[model samples]
Each structure stands twice: as C-alpha cells, then as structure tokens.
Target: MAASVDSPTPAASLNQEESTTGSTPFLRNGTVMSRSVKISSIPDPSLGTDERVGESDRAKRMKEDSLLLLRGFDSIAQNLSQLSSNLGSALQGARYLAEPPTLREIFHSRIENSESRQEEVEKEKIEGGKNTGLKRKFDPDERSEDQGNDFLNENEQCLEDKKLKKAKNLAVSMATKAAALARELKSIKSDLCFMQERCALLEEENRRIRDGFGEGTRLEEDDLMRLQMEALLAEKSRLGNENANLKRENQCLHQLVEYHQITTQDLSASYEQVITCLDFSSPTSSMMEEADNEDD
Candidate 1:
C-alpha cells in the first residue's frame, strides 16, 4: 500500500519538474505521463481512453497555435523593419527637398559652366580661322594660278561645311540643355509653392496648438513653439514605449493563459483517474473489512 502511494508521488514530482523546465515540452510530457498514470492506476480499461485521446488532440492543437504565433511575430518584425527603412528614406528625401540654396547653387553652376564652354568654343573657332587666313597669305605656292585657286576654293568650302556642322551640333546641344533647365526651373517653382502651402498649414496647426494652451503663459512665439514641439515629441516617444510594453504584456498574458489551460486539463484528468481508482477499489476494500471483522 505504501509502494502504491509512493509510485504516484514520484510521477507527480516528475511532472512538476517537467512543467517548470519548459512549456511546449512540458505539455507533451505531462499529457503522456497523465495517460500512463491513468492506465496504471485505474483497473477499468475503457474509462478514460477517449478523454486521453481528446487531451492529446488538444495538446497538438496548442503546439500548432504556438507555432502560428511565432510565425506572426516574425512577419510583424519584418514589416516593422521595412516600414522603418521606408520612413528613413522619406525623411532623407524631405531634407533634400527642403534645402533651396544647395539645389539653386548646383543648377546655377552648371548653367555658368555650359555658357563658359560655349564662349571658349566660339573663341577657338575665331582664332583658328584667323590663323588659317594668315597662313594662306604668307604661303608662296609653286603651282599654277588656276590650280591654286581651285585648291583654295575647295579648302574654304570644306572649312565652311565643317563650321556649319559644328554650329548645328552646338545649337542642338544648347537647345536641349535649355529645355532641361526650363523643366527643372518649373519643377523648382512647383516645389517652392508646395513648400509655401505646407508652411502655411503648419503655421495654422501651430496657432491651433498654441490656442489650446490658453493665454496664461507669457512666452515668445518661437520659444513657445519650440516647447510645444518638444512636448509633442516626448509624448510620441512615451506612447511608443507604452505600445511596446502593452504588446509584451499581452504576449505574457497569452502564455500565462495557455499554461493555466494545460494545468487545468492535467488536474481534471488526474481527478477523473483518481475517482476511477477509488470506485474500482471500493468493493475489494469492503470485502477486506468484512473478512477482518469475521476473523475478529
């Protein structure tokens, strides 16, 4: 009788130890242990077979649920990282667009450089023509007059054709560059208008925020605006922290609920097995008591 009592005590201790170590593994091991305990303790073969089968199914379902939660967490983390990256890129673009001086200076410098290059090209063409004319005048050709005239006309025609081609190319390049600059200027003007409207909206929002604080504070507009911005940023950070904490708390609560559910199932199964054992032993216990009384 002592050995029978002690056998169950060791199994229960082992179950407690397994439960403390880990959740998923403990659930599986506990279910198996409970089934074994039921089979060993209860003499009736068909009492808890269906109940044990149901418990095993529940354990499998809980395992699948935990896996799904883990997958959800992973997907959420990936989405958060993507959102953070996109936000960072958007901020960088906003900063780039906000600075007017840098963009204006870059475009102005490019226009100036193009103009200077065109001037240099014109000067080089003029210098080359003058040099060729001087060389022609200085040269004393031994060829006949008609031959020399024909050669000079052919050379002049070729130079004229080359100059015309170069001028045509320069005109095309300048026209293209001018069109590009005009488009860029138009875009800049639109951006400036947009920024102006945005600034106006921001000013309106600032006025509304300031009004909400009432007229009790006697501070400069800039100072008050700065303070308001600081307060808003602090509030945003606090809310973010609170949201993160809530998520953590929710996860913990879910885990606790699952643990309690498993514990409750284990307890209920143990209770049913104990009842069965007691029921099966009752007649034998009564018979033993009767025999003892007769012996007495």
Candidate 2:
C-alpha cells in the first residue's frame, strides 16, 4: 500500500511539473484509463503522444494562432472603415443642406416680389387726399380719373401676365424636379443596400473567425461592439431615407427652375415680337412723335 501511494504521488508530481513548464507534455489518460476507474490498472496517459500527429505538424498551431490574430486586426479595420463611411455620409448630407436647391431660392424670390407688388398696389389704391387732407387743385398737371384707371388697368394687366408666366414656370420646374428626385432616391437606396450587405458579410466573417478561435473564451467588449453596430445600422437607415427625400426635393426644384426659365424665355421672345410689330410711323406715335416734335 505504501509503494502504491508513492507511485501515484510521482505521477501527480510529474503532471504538475509538466503543466508548470509547458515546454513538456501535459498528460491525460488515453483509452486505457477510459476502460476502468482503477488508477493503477491504467497505462501511460498517451493523450500527448507523438503518434496522434500524422500528416499535420504541431507547428501548425502557431500558424493558426497568427492567422487568428490577423483576422482580429482585419475586423478592427473593417469597423474603422464603417465608422469612416458613416462620417463621410453625414458630412455629405451637411454639404447638401448648405447648397440647398436652386428652385426653392427662385420660388422664394418670386413670392417676395409678388408680395411687394401687391403692397405697392394696395398703397396706391388707398386714397391719399382724404387721409392727409392735402387736396390737389391742379387741372392740367393732374391725371384724370379715367387716365388713372387706365394706368391701373395697364399695371394690372402687366402684373397678371407676369403672374401667369410665373405660374407656368413653377409648374414645369416642379415636374422636372420630381423626376430627378426619383432617380436620386433609387441610387441612394441601392448604395445603402450595398452597405448593409457589406456589413452583414463582415459580421459573418467575424463569426467565422470567432468560431475558429474556440469557444472557451468570453470575448472582451463584444456586447459593446454589437450595440454600436446596431446603432450605426439604424443611423444609416435614417440617413438613407433623409437623403432620398432631399434628393427628391432637389429634383422637383430643379424641374421648376427649368420650366420657369423656359417660360421666361418664351415670354421674352413674345415681348420682342410685339415690340417689333408696333407701328411707330405716325408723328403722334410717341417714339416717332418725339423725333418729329424735337425737329419742330
């Protein structure tokens, strides 16, 4: 009994020494030990025996570890790439906001001008003589009511013509812009989908790498990384929608601008044609009359 106890102690001590050194093999009972619970009956623990390695070499483990380390770095690089892409996209959106759409600017300008014209017309229509008690006593110098009404009619016609042209221009611009926005939205959605697919592929790669590393480890900060990725995905989706909407608006505005420009050109051409056809042959025709009067 004493000898048997001493033998077990030596084996235990050898195991301890090998485990500490790591340079030597750490032993475990092979099939022999699995066959019985009797410790003494077990043969040499050949779990680390050289025979198990056939075509594969032990040095392959070092290469595998190095490869795993490389994969970890690759994952980190991918994460950085994702972060950069997000930042770039946000910056692009900001840039787009700064540029705004040209059609919107033109629309604002046109609306402001219309308001001013309306205010001027209202101020003119308000009878100045009654309010200020500054009654005019002139006959030849002052315009008759009929003449004043005629002038007002001309102004109204001019303003109405301008408003009609502006309306037609605005309608055309809106149509053009809508088409452009639709195209832009489609492009942006395609890019976003591609990014999502890339993200998924990276996640799959990470899972593959983790599996290769064996499951005994609780990866550090994996939860945090996953949460961050989720947040990024959400942000990306939101941005994609916003980009699509903005592009659509931009397209609509672009069309409006083009339509207005076309209408403005057409109106200018018509005005030129009318001016060309106007007869200036009579001495009372202001342009001809001015020359004839100047001669007298």
What Cα-based lDDT does every candidate model obtain? Answer: 0.67, 0.68
Q: What global local distance difference test value does model 1 have?
A: 0.67
lDDT of 1 by residue, 1-296 (tens): 55554356788888886776556876777787898999888766576797789999999999999999999999999999999999999999999989666434554566577668767966986796687667667764633564577577657656554544454444445445555655765785576567556557666878876786686544676587787667656755765675577567556555654654454354424334656756555788899999999999
Give the lDDT of residue 211 in candidate 2. 79
User: When superposed on Cα atoms, how far off is each prediction in RMSD?
Assistant: 51.3, 29.3
Residue-level lDDT of model 2, residues 1-296, one tens digit each, is 55544356788988875665565333334433454667666666575465567325656887899999999999999999999999999999999998857655666677678678877876875655344333334454444764587677767668666866667566646755665766777997787788788778767766765675575545555665567568767867887788777867777576666766676666545454656878756555778877888999
Candidate 2 minimal-lDDT segment of 10 residues = 24-33
Residue 10, candidate 1: how far off, in angstroms?
46
**What TM-score fits each model?**
0.26, 0.29
- Model 1 poorest 10 in a row by lDDT: 263-272
